[model samples]
Target: MKILLIEDEKDLAKSIQDYLKTNDFVCEWVTDFSLALEKIALYDYDCILLDLMLPRGNGFDILSHLKKLNKSDGVIIISAKQNLETRLEGFNLGADDYLVKPFHLSELLVRIQALIRRKKFDGNNIITFNEIQIDLLSKVVKVHGISIDVTKKEIDLLLFLIGNNKKVLSKEAIAEHLSGDMADMIDNHDFVYAHIKNIKKKLKNAESKSYIKTVYGLGYKWEDE
Candidate 1:
């Protein structure tokens, strides 16, 4: 999943980024409110970790901006402000969850998963479409009750495709989702094609239908046949 972390503490932000990365989350981080505002305005994220104390502006303003744009990105207030007023203000501004600072990274990870599940999957950890079953927590894929040997990236791709269903996803979008902050450094989207090819081959071997369809001159879509 894609996560935007708006934090001012450089060390804390890096630690959070590194911890989330190890759990297969694409995290883009900004240390100031200006950059955070720019990112939230320009792109979409599965979840945002917002700190109330920021350099240029308060994180509550970011929440107001998201509300103004009608963006539904799940937000968790990771702030040092533990007062009732601040918490209430955050919730009133549409924050999904709250996490006080000096918190455990593992707890934060689970919170993000819970928020995403509630937002995207109706609080279900298992995603099933036809004969395929994906366990979000275990990162496992099964077809016809048989397990498939797929890499983490393959599972991520599968979820990305299935989550969007019939929508055509551009290579750039997939690349950004996969690479996070390093996406700009990627000169070519060849890795996306490679990952898709690998996922298709593995699914085919498991006797699954060809759900991933390539749109010529465009991108790809996961269609249910």
Candidate 2:
């Protein structure tokens, strides 16, 4: 999943980024409020880790901005300020969860996963589409109760496709989601095709129907038909 960490503390931000990367998250860090605002306006993130006390402004303003834009990206307030008022305000501003500083990185990782689950898969750790079942916690895919061996990237792609369901996802979007920060550096998105092909083969080998559809001159979509 893609994450935006809006934090001013350099050390803390770096630690968070490094830890999240190890967990297969595409993490981007922005120290200042302006840069954070710019990123939130342009890109879509699965979860956002927001620090309340920023360089130029309070993180509450960022929440307000997200509300104004009607962005449904799950937000977690990762602030040092631990008070009833602050926590209530964050929840009032549409934050899904809040975590105080001095917490474990492992906890933060699970929190991000939980928020993304709530947003994308309706609060379920296991995602089901017909005969296919994906265990979010274990990162495993099964077809008709039989386990299918797949890589992490393929599982990520499967979730992306299934989450969007009938919506058409462009190659650029899929590239960005899969490659994270390196997406811009990579010139070709042909890898997306390869991943799709492998996923199709695995599913078909398990006696599952082809649910992934290609839209010529556009992109790909997951359809029941």
Candidate 3:
């Protein structure tokens, strides 16, 4: 999943980014509220980790703006203030969850996963598409009752495609989802093709139905029917 972390503490932000990366999540950081506002308007993210106090503007304003725009992106308030009023205000503004500062990274990750499940997958840990099954928590894929050993990126790619079945996903989106904002600095997206090919080969070997279809001169889509 893709996450936008709006935190001003550079060291903490870096640590959080690294932790999420290790756990198969693409995270982008935005210390400046203006830039963050622009990004939230332009692109869609699965979740937003917002800090109440920011450099340019407060996170609550951004949250209000997001709601005004009818953006359904999940929000998690990560602030130092742990009072009831702050927490209530966050919830009133439509925050999916709230986490206080100086918390464990692992705990934050768990909360994020829970929020995503509640928002996107109806709180299910396993995602099912036809005969194929994916365990979101374990990051495992099974076809026809047999386990398929695959790379992390392969699982991420498959999950992304499955979630957006029948929608054409461009190479750029795939790159960004898999590699975060740093993907933009890359020269070419040729490596995306390699990952797709590898995922297809694995699924084929498992005797599962081929679901990924490449759109000519565009991108790829996943559809079971």
Off by over 4 Å in 1: none
Q: Pick the candidate with the highest lDDT.
A: 2
Estimate every model's Cα lDDT from 0 to 1.
Answer: 0.92, 0.93, 0.89
List the candidates' TM-scores in order: 0.95, 0.96, 0.92
lDDT by residue for model 1 (1-225), tens: 899999989999999999999999999999998999899987788899999999989999999999999998999999888999999999999999999989999999999999988987889999998989999999989999998999888888888888789999999888877877687788899999999999899889989999999999899999988
- C-alpha lDDT (0 to 100) for residue 155 of candidate 1: 84
User: What is the per-residue lDDT of model 3 for residues 1-225, given as tens digits with 9 covering 90 to 100?
Assistant: 899999999999999999998888889889978988988986778889999999879988998999999999899999999999999998998898999989999999999998888887788899888888989998889999789989888888887888788999999989887877778799999889999999899889999898999898999999875
lDDT of 3 at 204: 91
RMSD of each: 1.2, 1.2, 1.7
lDDT of 3: 0.89
| Order by lDDT, highest first | 2, 1, 3
How much is 98 displaced in model 1, in angstroms? 0.7
Q: Please give the lDDT score for candidate 2.
A: 0.93
